[model samples]
Target: MMKFIGEAMNETMKRNFSECPPFFTPFGDTHKCISLFTPIKVSWFEARMFCESMTGNLAILDDINTYIQLLKYIEEKVCNCVNSKINKQCEDNERKLMPRFTGDAETCLSILEENFYYFSDEWCTVKLSPLCMTNKI
Candidate 1:
């Protein structure tokens, strides 16, 4: 489902090299000044491949600010260009593709680790219930 939403919506802008991250430093300066991208609904692996081919890797989400910034940057060129609105709409658009929040009862299995306490539990919420995601049905 490589739906090219941005291009379909007639939202294409020149890429801003100054906005490029330091890791892509070399290409940004040597490459085109315009950095317009087509946001397609690609599977995780496809997305990784597309990004690697075009720029680098699938953008990593470390913090909410960066996430919001990128969403705004993409949406603004497409819509009113507001980061907040873009974030909200983008979230809504993506949510349609997400699986249910709860894990499947029988199919879900937990790994019996040697030490549960040793698990850092990076993104776990206050409760484990929020973590199990439903499949795309």
Candidate 2:
């Protein structure tokens, strides 16, 4: 059956696409990881939807080092981009959420911000990142 074949192919792809250790695809192939800025505010689920709708999925922070650096970059950008107490607060909130989720969080769960990972060398090896999006939050 066509459905059966599709399912089989899906399974095959999932099996072959498995990532090793800390390396994982935070977003699918559609959306690219943005390095710039955009004040895109939405819920985590909404962010995922936005990513998918805009040709990607939610951002994923696989390690801690890159996460800390990225956090500082975002905060610095925010401090410079919009210097205000409220802006700082909002940016702080956003940074807190970035590395909150792991690759697999099927059910609603909490995250530990102490963890981090390295910079993704190539966006292609996974799926997304070329479209590094900035938050329009």
lDDT of 1 at 52: 54
Q: How close is candidate 1 to the true structure, as a TM-score?
A: 0.34
The TM-score of candidate 2 is 0.37
What's model 1's lDDT at 122? 20
CA lDDT of 83 in candidate 1? 48
**Cα-based RMSD of the predictions, in order?**
13.3, 16.1
Per-candidate TM-scores read 0.34, 0.37
Candidate 2 lDDT over 16-60, as tens digits, reads 233311112222232223332134434445545545564444454
Model 1 clash pairs are 14-34, 14-35, 15-34, 15-35, 76-81, 99-134, 100-134
Best by TM-score: 2
